[model samples]
Target: MTTWEPKSDLHHYLRVAREALLWKLDGLSEYDIRRPRTPTGTNLLGLIKHVATVESGYFGNVFGRPFAEPLPWLDDDAEPDADLWATADESREEIIGLYHRVWAHADATIDALALDAAGEVPWWPEERRRVTLHRILIHVISETNRHAGHADIVRELLDGAAGLRADHDNLAPGDQAWWEERRLRLEQVAQAAGQSEPRP
Candidate 1:
């Protein structure tokens, strides 16, 4: 086997983290991928969807090379929560493909700009004038991983899976009965904690 090297100043950590986030969603069904992990309805597919939009926005649109796509969740008039939970009719293949394309756009942003190349985010305060591709890469990587953790939980709640990274196959070995036992114990503990009152 041969070791790989990064082709540019885009940095290795950023590249690996980006690939890792996309890898986490592999082999999941649309319904399986879209179930809300929290009471707020954060999910795996929706996370990827949001990343695609934001990446394309920051890297493509902000730089004046707008990506060509009809992103409905990004509609400013729509409720913000709508972007966090996917609606029905979002095909797994389509969303995943869009993410792949967004990666291309983000990569181009990296390639075309120097580490110190400056940018101004119009949405931010005017005092914040300059930014760098290197910094943006780091920010997006952190953002992706942050939401990816939420994805991991959503996956576990849907099917009892947990890990910072899972390579397509389910490494969890316990049977459903074992999981049920653990889950019930957790629920009981949570309930007891919720009802406990402060000492007077």
Candidate 2:
């Protein structure tokens, strides 16, 4: 049995979220990983890049422990949404490498600070800028998991792959034909309900 402390538990969940997000990039080509799969231009590599920036800011800058690397995407003169996509010059390896570095930085912050250690989010509204390590941990975990969910959908769109993690899928057991039938059945039910509704 493994004994778990409060901070360890939080870090555990955050790590899981991080792994899930990175898993979405596995078995994908450079083009496929960088290609926008949604109307709003969401991509797997882009999501990872965005989360890296998010983690660096929240864990590093907010705590006055700045990341060593220069971030042109986050510069004051940079174009909008610069952090949300990878340019042609940015290789998959480079982006993923940066994300790994960010994970290390964030982990160091978690290990060094107490849960109640104080910090300030300068980018946040002034009234709500003050925060603690515990609050930032929870916030980053939520944000990372939210992006992981988005990655799940985006990966499914790319290659029909969907799972909660590498080992456990957490999906209903069904073959392709069974899934098609399920979809049709749901569509029929929805159509029947629609037909029964009175005209507005």
Best by TM-score: 2
Q: How would you encode candidate 1's per-residue C-alpha lDDT over 1-200 as one tens digit per residue?
A: 96653335345665665666666667777777877768777788888788777788778766666788778776789887565656787787887888888888778777787766666667767776456665666676778778767676677678765665555444466777987898899999998997895766
lDDT (Cα, 0-100) at 154 in candidate 1:
72
- How do the predictions measure up, each by TM-score? 0.75, 0.96
Question: Mind giving the per-residue lDDT tens digits that candidate 2 earns over 20-133?
Answer: 999999999999999899999999999999999999999999999999999999989998999989999999999999999999999999999999999999989999999999
Tell me which residue pairs clash in candidate 1. 156-161
Stretches of candidate 2 off by over 4 Å are 1-4
Lowest lDDT sum, 10 consecutive residues, model 2, at 1-10
TM-score of 1: 0.75
lDDT value, candidate 1, whole model: 0.72
Q: Rate the local accuracy (lDDT) of all candidates.
A: 0.72, 0.95
The residue ranges of model 1 lying beyond 4 angstroms of the native Cα positions read 1-10, 166-198
